[model samples]
Target: MAQQLILVTGAARCGKSEWAESLAIASDRAVTYIATATVDPADPEWQARIDRHQQRRPATWQTMATVEDLAQQIEGAEPTQCLLIDSLGTWVANLLDRSDVEWEKIAQALLAVLPTSRGTIIMVAEETGWGVVPAYPSGRLFRDRLGMLTRQIGSISSTVYLVTGGHVLNLSQLGQKLDR
Candidate 1:
């Protein structure tokens, strides 16, 4: 059987990334940290956040930093490679300017590769729907798209963890699946 697909999602600063990292560290496969964040040295706060994440990772692991090649990177992973993708929201935001048709194509391609993909895949996602509705069209678009993507991924994931308030809840085991 293929390894379980794990998803760790939560609000900002809720330790979701750390939880996902722990999962990767526990895996026997070679861990590869797949960063979806863009490197913007001009933004000190963003750079600091990235630096913190970088400092947290072990030197033995390989890091693939890319804003656009996430699906391709996942497709290229070795069967024994454990990929810890430290976010889905950043990746979505990076491509927010794409047309709806274009975005759908990209999303479909990613969904296609995920189902039968090899190795241990642990994804870190942000929960975006719990707050007030976005006030702008672009913001709404982002929230809807991300919400859809996470729900779809969560549907297929073998384990779904919701980390909030310093608590990690295994939604996959504790909650009922929503039938579409």
Candidate 2:
């Protein structure tokens, strides 16, 4: 089977994570859920959300949680295992302290490594641009940075899905259909 880089993007709470999980489950290879979310024991709501995500995943699937070394983790995985990265937004959020240049460097590294990655890769990202503009500068910065990262990843991805209100749009096909 052909390996694919699939990008699933949508607004918050639009079932993007569930969709990515479904795709990973459908893959023939072993699925490794590369979790980027940081758990805070002090926050009950955050803990509950994390618990919900954990419950949705299959028991057999391996999970690695790390904000950094994403590339290294992906590269070290077995060639036969599919890697499902749940949310790029969180990963980017974790690195907010880095300068734009530093963030860009990381993104560039990811873009370079992903094309050569062994197994089918699925990534989830939030489409935050559709909402109202952020009131604060940092929020705007995060939104803009995530947007740029999404475009870069989507451009390299074999297929891109835009999920909204329980619907999914095949962006690659849509682009072609519209061009014609």
- Best candidate, TM-score-wise? 1
- Candidate achieving the largest lDDT: 1
Tell me model 1's lDDT, rounded to 2 decimals.
0.90
Candidates in order have lDDT scores of 0.90, 0.87
Deviation (Å) of 77 in candidate 1:
1.7
What TM-score should be assigned to candidate 2? Answer: 0.94
TM-score of each: 0.97, 0.94
Q: Write the per-residue lDDT of candidate 1 for residues 1-180, one digit (tens) a residue.
A: 257688899999999999998889889788999999988878999999999999999999999887877779888877888999989999999999999999999998888878777877999999997989999999999999999999989988899999999999999889987885
Q: Give the lDDT of residue 29 in candidate 1.
A: 80
Predicted structure 2: lDDT: 0.87
Ten-residue stretch with the least lDDT total in model 2: 171-180
lDDT (Cα, tens digit) per residue for candidate 2, span 33-93: 9999999989999999999999999999999897967777777656788899988999989
